[model samples]
Target: MAQVLEFRLPDLGEGLTEAEIVRWLVAVGDVVEVDQPVVEVETAKAMVEVPCPYGGVVTARFGEEGTELPVGAPLLTVAVGAAATGTTTGNGSSGGMPSAPAAGTPGTAAESSGNVLVGYGTGAPAARRRRVRPTASAPAARVAPADEPAGAAEARVAADIADDTEQSGPVPVISPLVRRLAREYGLDLRQLSGSGPDGLILRADVEYAMRAAGAAAPAAPAAPAPAAVPGPAPRPPAVPTPTAAPVPAAPAAERIPLRGVRGTMADKLSRSRSEIPDATCWVDADATELLAARAAMNAAGGPKISLIALLARICVAALARHPELNATVDTAAREIVRLRDVHIGFAAQTGRGLVVPVVKDAHRRSAESLTGEFARLTEAAREGRLSPAELTGGTFTLNNYGVFGVDGSTPIINHPEAAMLGVGRIVPKPWVHQGELAVRQVVQLSLTFDHRVCDGGTAGGFLRYVADCVEQPAILLRSL
Candidate 1:
């Protein structure tokens, strides 16, 4: 008889708890091999293809596309022992499971896989051993035919599927939908203290607990009463407490939920505003020399130099002088950490939303290399194919708001990073050059920095260095 095994969703690291099903790769009745991707899920971190561990017929699917499922929820179920025993054959339709021949067989006798996932494997864990019931009294004992209910494989499967509802512990979660709902509302399952049956936390239980918590929290105390005077008070008319007028209802409007990339951006931006005491400083500089240098480099060269890449090179040189600007703060330990490697991130806008793709070891890359990497990451961003690692761990951000035709902006600092440099449009403007008025290519640069990381002097020095390179590209020769 084939034993039915359940496959649960494995954890995709980086502290993600749940994922939304973007597409289903396999159906309920299809036969699947071990380690085959069964569903494509979109987590808060990135888009991932989740693989199934068990190899056999897919008994049941738990969720539909666009439905969110929490970790440890069942992705599918498979029968393990049928192929090893040769009792099940292809093209057989006993139940809803398709009995096609599986390619990645778990092997004979102890049929199972070794590489299931990071946390789970083909067989049961060592703590819980699987025991196969004895079928006969002796080696040559009676072997029941396939028709008898006592020895029938299909009958055993039916019985096993029927008894899946009973639980041996206090965790009484039976549906993935309930888990997803609880996660979406930010409810902790471990804190599932409820009077539910068998200590199970039900939907109503979570809802009631949240309501009780809200009700128990006291509102801000009424304005403190004035201190009493020593002398007796004169007769004073009581001032009526003014009642607040009711607010009128507005017309209904469309609503959209923030769950994926948009939600991640919102959370980070809000936290940055609340935690970082940031300030912005701006200065205008002549960029005619920088543009001419880039043109010269490309004109004589094998690899064309991009404007942003040149700006990145200049930023790297400036950070070498003012290392304090390339650092983040450890609030708990109250220490300022100066990073050794300069990983620069550039802001890219996509259909998904605004995302920052980091270029690792930006200090070591040449202008041509940085230009190539930026183009690759930007294209990936447009196609929404960037991985989580590509989107994180940036030491500093260089935002070219010039692409949007803006003169200046006090853009928010990408949280945890010490500062960001915003470059504006480089256009021809009238300026006094060497005692005569001339049309010069000018640009505005702004730096929004965390005040806690460095004092204003360090910030000003870094901005001034960047402006110097922009005005006289030859200044970069010493550092290069």
Candidate 2:
């Protein structure tokens, strides 16, 4: 008999709790190999392919595409062992699961993947999976029916376990959704006992508590019971006040849900606005020389140097002088974290949404290398294949809004990072060249920096240095 093993959604890291299934790579009755990506999920950060650790015939899948599943929810069930090799229901039916798979074949008891996601694998410690069966008194702690939605089942379990479990030690909560729910309602997790195994707090527990509190609230003081029985014949039973007529409901407007990449961008931009006191300083530079320099380099070089890469090189040089702009504000520690490596992120707009893909160790790369990385990341962004790791850990961002045909924009700083350099269109404009009127290639450069990190003087200096480098590309040679 094939023993079926359940695979839960592993933690995708970056503190993400839930993910919406965008596409299912494997279907029930399909044989899968260990470390094979079975599903593509979109989290708040990026689109990720979730690889299953067990190699076997997929017996059943949990959520359909577009369904948001919480962390630790069962993603699918796989039947392992030699018994699964030749057995397939004629109509591709998923039979009942027997016992756990014994070590026989790949994806069986002995063979499982070493990598599923961060901090998760088939080889996880047995202590993490240990469970004690609920006693008769805890009748509510039964397993959810197969057909029940995971959220609903979890909520039900949580509500039932809240009253039965004793609370202690770090408030056994694993789901980020539960934490968010408790936070939104201002419920302290420490005060409530969880209704999950090992006293784990669940969403239902919070909802139950909220409902109980609402039901227990005093009801309008019973309208004061009409005071005196002998009040002048009860004042003719006092005419009741007229109630307002019900108004017709307004037509519902189309609402785009703030979830996935767009949702994450909204949150990050909002946080950047609310938390960081930012300041923008812009300067127009004559880039005629810079353009000529790039052209000359490309003519003599083995690899074509991109304009953005040159700008990135300029940014690296400028940051070397102004390290304050290459750091983040550590609010909790009350310190400024100056990063040693320059991982520059550039804004890339894709079909999914606007995403900033970071080029790691950008300062160490030549203009040619930076150009290649930027192209690779851009392609990945457009294809919706960027990982969360690629989407984060940026020290500074270079936003070339020029490609959009825009002259200038006060770009929002990609949050946590102290500053961003915005490059506008490098158009030919009439200007005084060498004290003579001429048409020069001019571009507007703007720098938005966290005011908490530096004052206007430092920001102005950084922007000024960048503008200088753009006007005279030779100025970058000193730093190089």
Candidate 3:
């Protein structure tokens, strides 16, 4: 007796509702092992491969390819029993048996579900789907004499097609319906060269061919002597060339049918934007001294510190001075959430999307420690290994657009916090030094705040204080 087990789509993290199936590695009747990748699903931001949760023989596929499956939906059925150990055979009554086409046939389906893992069970039935190839039947006509060379006849046919195309004008060929129409009309594509890019024939070409063939032939008339020419004839107005039709616009506000990371991002961003009252303050910082100090620190066996790491340290110090910047506003209870620890979340661009991984107890950590953590977080982010804990629970957020060569932008405040700091690129500009103009490395900082929690003056002062710390790195050491 075989024991059947159902494999439902798991909650792919972040309370997502659905995920678009990208590809299936296992098909019906194929054996799969636990923790082996069985399917790839595309979330809104990136494609993630889901692994098999149980070891068994694949019995059924619940949905077809390209289907958007909701979470908790049964995706595949598996059999767990003695036969499931090896040489597993599935029940054939309920579309569970593989029906793959034989090899060497046109459009033969390929099977990917074999012994995918080393030392995995074998002798499972192959589960592959067949794809149909289209065939066309042309109208019967008298065959041309073989005396005519194929090349010359093809050229004449091409010229005739060109003439017809010129008369009918241009047409697009993106839709499947258009291709079907062309095939049904018995349009000789080789004769009528395509007008589209890369020589793709259009619907207009077929229509023109049909119309030209249907037109009445000229009637025979008697030839006569030419009449005397009249005075210069008036020139006809210039006719404008027809433009290609614009590609169909997507529906206004496409229903993304959100799932996975996008769904989570939407919920979080909406809550932050709607619940938080944001305000911003601007400050220009001269980073000449900060750059020199960072170079010295790096040269002296300290980890290579980026401007973002230095700024984060300065922000932590400033928050220490003014605890309000680090506090969260609870409008519901009319209270402030002042936490004892500071977790500075620095926004890092990752393969999945924009993620802010936190540096826990940022204020307590030394500059070198923060630098090491930043490096680890960035590496984890790029490798798509950041956990929920690493991504969440931050007293403040920082966005560095300077890497993309941007000067400054008012970054949207990542919620639960009153503000976020935007760091810009450091560039050398003219500045007054002891009443004399000299080149100095300057950077613009934009701090976006939640107005409900902080006034403009408080926000401005906090930014100024942070800038002061950056201008004097020794200030951070003294504050600590």
How many residue pairs clash in all the candidates, one count each? 0, 1, 5
lDDT of 2 by residue, 52-74 (tens): 87765565789999899999999
Candidates in order, TM-scores: namely 0.65, 0.65, 0.60
Model 1, 97-157: lDDT tens digits are 2222222444522223222211111222233322222222212222335466644644543
A best-first ranking of the candidates according to their lDDT comes to: 2, 1, 3
Model 2 RMSD, rounded to 1 decimal: 17.1
Residue 26, candidate 2: how far off, in angstroms? 2.4
Estimate candidate 3's alpha-carbon lDDT, on a 0 to 1 scale.
0.65
lDDT of 3 by residue, 41-154 (tens): 865434578886656556567777778898999988665433111343343212222222333344322222221111111221233211111123334233445697868754
Query: Using alpha carbons, what is the TM-score of model 3?
Result: 0.60
Model 3: runs farther than 4 Å from truth? 11-25, 40-49, 63-68, 83-259, 350-352
Q: Which pairs of residues clash in candidate 3, taking residues 3 or more apart in a chain or in different chains? A: 277-450, 277-451, 278-449, 278-450, 279-449
Give the residue spans of candidate 1 off by over 4 A: 1-4, 79-82, 85-251
Candidate 1 vs 3: which has more lDDT: 1
